[model samples]
Target: MFKAKNVIRIGKGANAVLARPLSGIPLAIWAFSLTFALALGSTAAQQTPPPNPHSPPPTSVTHQMYLDMKLGTLNIHGDNAVVEALVLQRDIPITYDYVATLMRTPNAFGEGPACIVCHSSNDQLKSYRGLNLSSCEGILLGATEAPANPIVIKGEPFQSHLIQRIRNNRMPLGTPFFAPVDTDSILAVKDWINAGALNDENFTTKVLPLFVDPVAFGSETACTECHKSFRDPPSFNEVNLTSYDAIMTGAFSKTRKKQNLPGLPIVVPSNAEASPLYQRLTTSRMPPGTDPGSPADHPNTLLLMRWIEQGASCD
Candidate 1:
């Protein structure tokens, strides 16, 4: 398991300044007699570099100083001007490996893909309360502050919406999402949530591997082999799902024209329902052949549906 270290804070002070290696030397040389003479001369001349000649004179000394500082004064303020720097170090948890292992095994629920059983369009479209497993990041992040309602993030395993849904008898009730998630997985998710659900490099690298199929299925192979021509745009109306990037970007469309739908967008992050490819697969209307059967008749189609529902990802 990966562990993160505490944040390091460096406070600003004279010591901090002195610790920094000095750069170029100042042009002016100060001596006791020279400084005394210069001070006396300045007082007699009533001249103090014309209070920064480049800057506009202030209406008053205090106001002038304030405006000059605001306008980019070279002078630094007192101790209050000190800056504090903080560095955070994070580690990716090994729970992602466990998730990958679980995904590879047959779902106990006798579903297509164990991962998809809990994640795809079918789950999200349900009328009752349930966690949308489409995007792990989305579920972890929860909703942003909006006008109508604010989504909350659960810092602990028991408090998380995903955890609560899994525990509930209503959801994944008969599904794998309801399946027993290991304590390590729960803790990993909890740690991620507590850490602000950041999509940092480490988190992404770990999470992505869990979402991709360990073994390539027939549909992925068949689609890649048989559908070479449709891979590019203008030939198949500019909708290409030949690659993961294309799928996430919503490059596939049967109508050859783009249309807007409610819920999640196909190309937008966490917008699986709005994705046309998912819609076609879940609806059992894909392969674009002359005769397409119901979704129930196609196992490959089912797999694709499950993959999408589980969070369509390249990893």
Candidate 2:
């Protein structure tokens, strides 16, 4: 602090200053100095650069405003004026169901994309990271590893881990680098988060799939015998293959010890090798002690394989 004549010059770092005085200083001089300092500060603040509204104010969250110009209904001078004058284009609000669509659909973001291929309720990878990106609720609930932070922050898009992971290509592991989630999809996630991630009021919730429908699966291999009951060494108790919808839902493997491959799908459409349902039926792996068995040549097994290869339409 430096005192000169009647005004005390208070140093406010390199770019600003505070002007005050003691009782001994002349009140008139002090007042004049204070006015001049305020004027100087106003000019300096204006010339500083574009104001970041998000930044906290020096004294409090409240900010000082002084507008000198106006045109029509718009302010043409001052920080708020500048911001109000410029047209800020906003995107349409995104819904919770929309995010789920991105997760379930293949190549929805673009080339060679598949999120549900690995992050479903039954997917082995879901347990590893504890994130089931299969549904909106799952995203909001977050993963076991990040229990403290929700995957999607309601109004802060960038703050959401879900968006950050997609933006940084940390999701859909094993996907080709050239065909990561597209920009539009990434932006959609951000927009959805910013829009409050509302769910569809009319959303008809269905049980997540465990396997392709055995009835619709075009198979007659008596799947319910082993799947419905644990009479054999391996029991498919996690899922019921008897019902059409139940079959389409997930069936986590009891034998797969790896927790890292969470939400692994059993009936990924259009890809035979990707679908465990198609694999188990086609091979002698199930109905134990049937290596090169009679079931391998069974027409029902062939029908099931064809159904999966044809994109396993649950409809």
Candidate 3:
């Protein structure tokens, strides 16, 4: 440790300041150095971090904030301030507190008990299908150890058995905790799982805006330019790329209907290769002519594909 006194040569007058020495150093010099050191320490301790506009507010609720930032009320998912608050942070956080809340909150409309009540496991009680919603680990580990049909498919929410049950009106046992498990709630879970079923709330805050933000996107063609609604009439295929919710909520495909199958989701959370949006950029190039546009590994197409791999957060 470099002490100020060691580096500082006392002036010739030092002997006059305090003739008596404490240990070896003069008492007056020691006192002055101690005072200065305390002052510096105090200043450093009191220093506030440079304002981080992207950090979540102390009073903000993660679940509510997630919903608020992605309500789909406007074409832009959230205000710039709110979006920045969720992004631009040192390290994106991971938490499933909101999902836990979803499982525990009593159903206002349904006569049945909360999801947790029936899905939890304990010495005295065990839910059917061995599903346990009481903890994050249990949910991710899923119902059966290795069922023929898996419960949660990590990056594929639609394929997850849990979502399938809710969508099919088979969950919560009785009247159902959320009537039909409100679209918003189901979407929340979908976002949760589609994000590789992790707790990173940044999964929604940091990614997905690339679709509309051409500057950040680093390309002449913005995906939202053609995909987002608000055109003269409306976007082709009714696929609104305006926000996270819109992109995740894909448009119907006649091809799938012809085969009596469901259409593939445009952006499948953490799976870009499986996403049709990426597929178009690679095969059957999207922007039509231009001698067939950018290649599959083109920077622009790779950008979109990469976004999905990062959980495709909308705001």
Candidate 4:
């Protein structure tokens, strides 16, 4: 526990200056100073409650979702290919430990490496989202936002939100645009869930760094600055520009309804003019609060447009 101290002593001179009219300072500067002070004061006045250690971690499969991606795509990688191939050929069931090992290993396709980022007990998002994916049991608990549907529904992969979200590239929240879970990986999850998402797997944990696709990811990962993911009711949550795949996945738009058509493509390979991503940035409809088509954003936009013009290769 800590105690507050009166650190500032206002002398008569300082008081006199504050009490005096704003004749000396410019109106713009004065107004800016006042606004800054009020904002700071308001921030200081509000207090965030301390994290409760007793609060159990969220039990959603959000983190396990990443693990599922890793485990599901074992056939594509070199080392795991032997065992996975054998398992597939013999029609032998994939075991929990084998899947766990695959999860611990880094995926070649870059779905993700681990579940600790947002699912750990100490993770802030766990508390906010009421979902934890730190363990097999935790993942089975489902997201707080959608408790009715288990994140992984044993024997029914299609009914599982975990599969649906990953298939749609909506889970893992803030991944890069070109990094959707590949078809093979999605199928792996589907198979695993159908086999029952078991927890008996013994995994020797090792650190596998996340895979970054330089061509597609570039520098942007955060998109909430220009887009929203959470809606008032969780169901209304829309797709964000988190990755190249996400961009390609396309989002539902207000215009889609008015025009009575399906959503528009954000990126159309070899067609920058047709790309909503290029047009929106160039036309200045995004970065919501910025000057429309601000020059500051044009260079990146141009590079992206050119990439699209070159057929938007994922490689």
Candidate 5:
């Protein structure tokens, strides 16, 4: 009736005893006992239950998962130390859905909704400020026509512009609206920055254009035709295309009224195949006044496809 622990201890002791030979009779008896004990110990250990190696360690609990809703892929990873803190301190799984919820209803400082919600040139929050959180390339790589500089995301908080603003408390100011941000949100951002602001397990564009050059697409004009006058408010389609902010927010026709299709938005960047704008340009369905042209005959169609393939980012 030996318990699991006792069985193991007895097995070890039998081995030690059997290592040295005593009187013939004692040694023979000891050998038999040792064999039986070893077998029992092994059986008990096997039935005791195997450790869950895949389970994150108790102290480590930084969990992250990326969902490219359009791509239909789920990328997941975890750091037990960080995950534990996220669970115990933040009480949330670091998943795309979770992050999206945070972004939609961000804290005072506007931290959440993932990077695309803020860095994108077509973000809904463009009207509030000229900030685009869709892609880091335009803002961080200076790929946009405006020529923004690279945004470093490493080292001390002072080194990074994003961190500096957060640390200096210059962000989440109450000019247009005022709301308090949570300490945990700020810490999470700091932790992300400290970790080199990695895009691993996150949806990212494979290639980013140097600039949103309409000329490259054989268009002599910018997106001013239908997007101008956004600098003021209530721009065409309730969108502003004057700056990165406006463009991101205005690019897509959210309401069904403005949408080309009966029940679909004009632009669904995530689903290029389903977007009416892309279908119109890439296919033979030109607008009312434009000359009827085939999708293959239109160079702009290729450009639009390339843009969509590049995540349709305004950055």
Candidate 6:
């Protein structure tokens, strides 16, 4: 460990500012960071090169390895076609819909019954983390619902918390100890996020139905269970998720400032990970009495992201 040292100024006047290192930086750590910064001229991700379709998926197919492999070799000229081809190369097409299928499949990884056998059950709140993997919308909301830390950070898979948890063996959490999922599945998902985590179909087809489905939130009641004023609710806190019109015109009233509760946005078009409403369902905060959701949970946070990514459109 590099011990903290007071930085010394070597030059007089304004040149001292240019010559000296910042005070709190540890020399070794600073040097290491600068070595890469100087070599790359920017964080490696500043160049969002699509994966080379012909290149094999890394034997260790996490985002970090992907970056290092590409950057070390200076192969940074990939394009949309390459991204499409690379992520689509697996036995399966990686998209929100496929993830939902895996969520519902019986004994998906030989660890236990399908994830939804438990996560989607009404009783999930009693034993599990309260994430409802029942639909694309719920999945996009993510498990933790932590706003600042999104489950899927599009175009930057390594930064996504979902990838972090899976690589660390912390998800698919259930009986049989949430063993590592298949390597192919993990790689496919990572590449999908790195490629902007697009939806297989339109938002209306994949996500809008979820807004009206009661069971999607692990509750018999739908989002309409609360906030009935789709057009004009009485309070600033309540938002209308009842219709496409209401949802698009999120918080129709500017009277939100006067309300006692904090007026957070329900949906942010093309950015579901940042939307508090999506975060609410993913963290299992809705339907009453579950962990307060944040946009941070991984397993429960991609479908809605795709919806938002697709412009949060109705049609």
Q: What is the C-alpha RMSD of each candidate to the true structure, in Å?
A: 25.8, 26.3, 23.9, 27.1, 26.2, 19.2
**TM-score of each predicted structure versus truth:** 0.19, 0.25, 0.29, 0.27, 0.21, 0.26
Top candidate when judged by TM-score against the true structure: 3
Per-residue CA lDDT of model 1 for 187-284, tens digit only, reads 34334434544466644654323223222221222222332233344333244334444433343343333365322223433433323332222222
Worst 10 residues of 6 by lDDT: 169-178
- How do the candidates rank by lDDT, highest first? 3, 6, 2, 4, 5, 1
Candidate 4 structure, TM-score to reference: 0.27
Candidate 3: where is the Cα deviation over 4 Å? 1-94, 108-111, 122-125, 145-149, 170-252, 255-315
Whole-model lDDT, model 5? 0.31
Off by over 4 Å in 6: 1-201, 230-236, 252-254, 257-264, 284-315
Best-fitting candidate, measured by lDDT?
3
Sorted by TM-score, highest first, which candidate order results? 3, 4, 6, 2, 5, 1
lDDT of each: 0.30, 0.38, 0.42, 0.34, 0.31, 0.41
Model 6: lDDT equals: 0.41
Stretches of model 1 off by over 4 angstroms after superposition: 1-222, 226-235, 242-245, 252-265, 286-290, 293-315
lDDT of 3 by residue, 45-159 (tens): 2334454568665464444333332332111111122122332221233235434544564531122346776678632236655767687667766765333234566555555
Better of 2 and 4 by lDDT: 2
For candidate 3, which ten residues in a row score worst on lDDT? 73-82
Put down candidate 2 lDDT per residue, 216-267, tens digits, no spaces: 2223334554455212244343544544344444554332324643323445
Off by over 4 Å in 4: 1-84, 101-113, 121-128, 146-148, 170-315
